[model samples]
Target chain A: MNELVHGALYGTLIATAILSTIAMGIWFERKFAGRMQQRLGPTIVGPAGLLQPFADIIKLLQKEDIVPRDADRGLFDLAPILAVVCSLGVAAVIPFSPSIIASDLDVGVLWVLGIGGLMVIPTFAAGWGSNNKFALLGAMRAIAQSVSYGVPLVLAVLVPVVLSGSLSISGIVAWQAQHHWFAVWPIVPGLPAFVIFFLAMLAESNRIPFDIPEAESELVAGITTEYTGAKFTLFYMAEYVHTLVGSALGAALFFGGWDGPFAPGLHWMVLKTLTLFVLIYWVRWSLLRFRADQLMRLCWTWLTPIGVALLLVSAAWVTFGGTN
Target chain B: MQSAWLSAFAFLLVSTLVGAGLLGAASVLRVRAKYDSPLKHNTYECGEEPAGMSWMQFHARYYVVALFFVLFDVEAAFFFPWATVLREEGTSAFIAAVTFAAVLMLGWLYAVRKEALEWQ
Candidate 1:
C-alpha cells in the first residue's frame, strides 16, 4: 500500500508539474513569438496571459469527443492514454533534486530511454487506430524520423554514461559535481556529443524544426488529425510532457541536474530544466523545419558519427585516467 | 576482448528479454478492434485518397542505406570502451583505434561515393 501510494504520488505530482510547465511553455512561446512578430500575444487572458493555458485546457476539455466511423474504437481510446502514460512515467526516474526523485533505479538512464520508446507505440497506434490516411502517414513519418534520431540520441547519451561510469542519472550528476562540467571540461580527444544530444533531443521530442510528423500545413495536424476533445487534449498534454521529459533528461545528463550554488536542490533542478526548455524554444523559433530526407541525413550522417566518436574518446580517457 | 564481448552479450540478452516481455504483456492484455471503410482504408493525403501504394518497390538505395547503417552501428558500439581508455593507451592505442576507425571509414567513404546513402 505504501509503495502504491508512493507510485500514485509520483505519477500525480510529476503529471501536474509537466502539465504546468507545458502550459507555461506555450504561454511563453506565444508571447515571445508575438514580440518577435511585433504583436501582442494573449495579453487579455489575465496579466500577460498567464492564465491562458488554463483557458485553453478548459476549452479543449469542453470540446466534443469525436471518433471516426469505422475506426478501431479500442485502440483509438488507448492511444492517447498510452502516450500520456509513457511521457509522464519518464519523470519517475528524473531526480528533481538531491533528495527528491520518484524512484532512483540503478539503471535510471536506460529505464528512461527504454520507456520513452514506448511513447512511440501509442503514436503508431494512434495513427493506425484512427482509420485516417493522414494519421497513418503521420504515424509512418514519426516512425522513420524517431528511429533515425533515436539511434544517435542514445549513442550520444552514452558519452556522459561513460564519463560518469554509471547509468544512474543521480550518479551522473554526482560525477559532474566532482568533475568539471562537460561544457567546460573537454572529454579527452574532444567530441561534441552534447551538441548531437541536443539536436537529437529536439528530433526525439518532435519539436519544431523536427516536427515533421505533425506538419500541420502539409498533413493537417498529421497523425492527430482525427482526434477531438479530451483525447486530443491528452495528445497535446503528451507532447508537452515529452518535451519536459526531454528537457529534463538533457539537464540531468549534460547541465548537471540540481547542481548549483545559490539555490536549494529542487530550485536548482527547476532552474536548469527551465533554462534548457527556454533554449529549446529559442532554437525552435529561430530555425525552420528540415525536409524529411534532410532530417534523416543529419541524424545518420552527422550526429551518429559524432556520437560514436564522443563515446569512444570518453571511454579511452576513462580507461587511461582511472575508471570511474 | 572476451570479457567485453561476454558482458555485452549478457547486457543484450537481459535487455531484450525484459523488453520483449513487456511488449508481449502490452499486446496480450490490450483490447483491439477492426475497422474497414473506403475512406479509412485509403492512404491519407490530406483526406484525399492516396494516389498509390505507400509501399512501392524502391530502387536499390534504401537497401544500400540499411546495409551501411548496420555496418557503422556495430563499429560505433565498439568505439565506446576504446574512448574510455584512449589517453592511457597512449600512442599504441591511438594508432590501433585510428586504424580500426580508418578501415570502417574507408567502407563508409566508399559507400558515400557510390551514392549508397542517398534515399529515394
Candidate 2:
C-alpha cells in the first residue's frame, strides 16, 4: 500500500514535469526557428511569447473537434491516445538523476527501444483510419522510415551496452562516470557510433533531412490530414514528446548523462538534453527533407552496415583494449 | 524489483488517464458546429471532389523494406546478449558476434544483389 502511494505520487509528478517541459520546448523551438530564419516568433503571445504554448493549447481546446464522415471513428480516436501513451511509456525508464527516475528496469535499453518501436502502429492507425490517400501514403512512408532506421538505432544503442557491459541506463551512466564517456573514449569506434546514433536518432524522430513522411509540400500534413482540434494537438504533442525522449536517450548513452563536474543533479541531465534538442532543431530548420528512395538507400546501404561495423569495433575494443 | 515494475505500470496508467481526461474535457468545452454539410466532411484531396477510395493496394517495396527491417531487428536482439557478456567473455564472444554478423551480412548482400532495396 505504501509503495502504491509512492508510485502514484512519482507518476503524477513525472507526467506533469514532462507536460510542462514539452509545452516550454515548443515555445523554445519556435523562438529558435524564428531567430534562425530572421523573424520574430510569438512575440505578442506573452513576454517574448513565454506563454505562447499555453495560449496555443487554449486556442486548440476551443476549436471544433471534427470527425470525418467516412473515417473509422474508433481507430481515429484511439491513434492519438496510443501515440501519446507509448511515447510517455519510455519516460518511465529514463534516469534523469540517480534518485529521480521512475523505474530503473534491468533491461532499460531494450525497453526504450521496444516502446519507441510501438509508435509506428499508432501512426499507421491514424493514416488508415482517416481513409485519405495522402494520409495512407504518409503512414506507409512513416512506417517504412521508422522501421528501417530503427535497425541502426538499436544497433547504435548496443555500442554503449557493449562499452558499459550493462543494459541498465543507470549502470551505463555509472560506467561512463567511472571510466570515460563512450562518445569520447576509443575515439575510433566511439565517435563513429555517436555520429551514427545521432543521425539515426534524427531519422527515428522524423526531423528534417528525414521528414519525408510529413513533407508539407506534397502530403498536406501527412498522417494528420484528417485530424482537427484537440486530436491534432495530441498528435502534435506526441511527436515533440518523442523527440524529447530521443534527445534524452542520446544524452544518456553518449554524452555522459547527468555526470557533469560543477553541479551533480538533474540540471546536468537537462542541460545535456536541451543541447541535443537544440541541435536537432537547428538541423530541422537548416536541412531539406530527403527523397524517400534516398532515405531508404542511406539507411540500408550505409547506416546499417556502418552501425554493424561500429558495434564490432566496440566489441573488439572491449576484448583487446581492456578498457571498462 | 516488483514494486519498480508496479510503479512503472502505475505511471503508464496515470499518464494515459490524464491524456484521455484532457481530451475528454476539450470535447465537452469546445464549441460544436451542429450544422452538417455533406460536402464539408469529404476526404480532403487539395480542395477537389472525392475520387476513388484510398484503400488501394500499395507497392511491394514497402513489404521488402519491412522484411529487411525484421531481419536486422532479430539480429540486433541476438547481439544484445553478446554485448552484455563481451567484456567478461572477451575473444570467444567477439568471434561469435562476428560470425553472427557475417551470416546476416550475407542476407544483406543477397538483398542488394536482388535489388530489393531499389525504389521503383
Candidate 3:
C-alpha cells in the first residue's frame, strides 16, 4: 500500500509476534527454573501452565497504578514505554530468515547496536524520575554495567562485520553460508568473540549474573522500586524482550542463522534463537550475581581488551584473504 | 533511501502506539481504592518515615566509567566503516585501524592504572 500503512501493518505484525514470543519465554523460564529448583511451577494456570504469562499480565493490569509522591510523572511514565518500544524496534531490523526480515536495512548491524544501546536511557530515566534512593543507586549500577560492557559488545560485534566485510546482518549470514560459519572456521578469534558477545549481551539485558542493579536485597527491585502494576510489568517485560532480540541478533551474527543441513528457512532461525534464549536461563539460574567492582573489572580488563584483540585478528585475517 | 527511513519512523510510531495502548488499557481497567493514604505515595522506604530528599548529588563513581564508555563506544563506531571496506582496502585499512586501536588501548590502560574503573 503506502509507506506509512505498510510499515505500520508489518510493524504491528512483527511487534505482536515478538510479544507472543516473549510470553512463551516467560513460560519457558518459569518451567525451566521450577524444574531446576525441583518444583513443578505454575502448573495450575493452563495445560502445563501454558497460559500463565497471560494470566499474570491480566492480574498485573488490574492492580493499582502507584506513582510515588513527587515522582516526575512525565518521565516515570515515559521510561517503561520507551523501554518496550526500543526493545521491539530492534526486531524490525533483524533478518529472521532468508526473506522473512521486516525492514532489512543495509546497516542492519548498526540498527541492532544503535537501538539496543538506547536501552540505557529508559533505565537511568526510570531511576531519576522515581526519586527514590534505592532506585537511583540501582539505576546507576545498571547504567554502569551496561555502558562498561557496551564497548566490548560493540567490539565483539565488529568481528562479524570484519569477517563478512559488510554491516548488514543478512550480508553476514550469506557470507557464512558461502564460506564457513564464523563460529567454526576461524577457530581462533570467532569463538572468543562470540563468547564476549554473549557475556556482553547478558550484561546489557541485566540478567542474573550481571543483575546487581536489581539485587532485591540491596535496592528493592532497583529502577522499578517506585513503579507499580502495569508500569512495573512493562519494565520487567522490556528486559525479556531485550534478551530475546539479543539472542536473535546473536544467532544472526555467529551461529550461521537459518543455515541448516536438511531444510534451511525460518524454522532454523527460530531454533537457533530459542537455543540461545535457553542458554540465557541456564546462565541465570546457575550463577550468582557479580560484585559491582568484579563486573566492571571483567568488562574493562578482560572482555574489552580481548574483544579488541579478536577484532584486530579477524580484520587482519580478512585483509590477508583468509575469508577468500 | 527516504522510504527506508519513513518505514522505520512508521514502525516507531506504531510501537509507541502499542505501548501507549497497553498502558491506557491498564489505567482504564485498574482498581482505584476507596481510601488513599499519603504513606502509599511517599517514595518507598523500608516502613520507617523517610527523612530528607530522595534526590542526592553523591555517587559520582559512575561518571568516570561512563566517560570511558563514551570514548570507546565512539571509537567502536569508527571501526564499522573501516571493517566494511577492509576486504577492498586490504592491509592499508588494517594498519590505520590498528594504529587507532593502539592509541585507544593506551588510554584505556591509563584509566585502569588510575583505578578509574574501580567502584571504590
Task: Supply every candidate's count of residue pairs whose N, Cα or C atoms clash at under 3 angstroms.
Answer: 14, 0, 0
Q: DockQ score of candidate 2?
A: 0.73
Q: lDDT score of model 3?
A: 0.87
- Docking quality level of the chain pair in candidate 3: medium
In model 3, what is the error at residue A257, expressed in angstroms? 1.6
The deviation in Å at residue A217 for candidate 3 is 1.6
Q: After superposition, how far is residue A116 of candidate 3 from its true place, in Å?
A: 1.4
Clashing pairs in 2: none
DockQ of 3: 0.78
- Sort candidate 1 into its docking category: incorrect
Error of 3 at A238 (Å): 0.3
Which tens-of-lDDT digit does each residue in A229-284 have in candidate 2?
Answer: 88888888888888888888888898778888879758998998888888999999
Best by lDDT: 3
**Quick one: ranking by lDDT, best first?**
3, 2, 1
Candidate 2 lDDT, B1-120, residue by residue in tens: 566677677767876886697799798879888896777788899998769898979799889898888888888888887788888888989999999998889988888888898775
Whose DockQ is greatest here?
A: 3
DockQ of each: 0.10, 0.73, 0.78
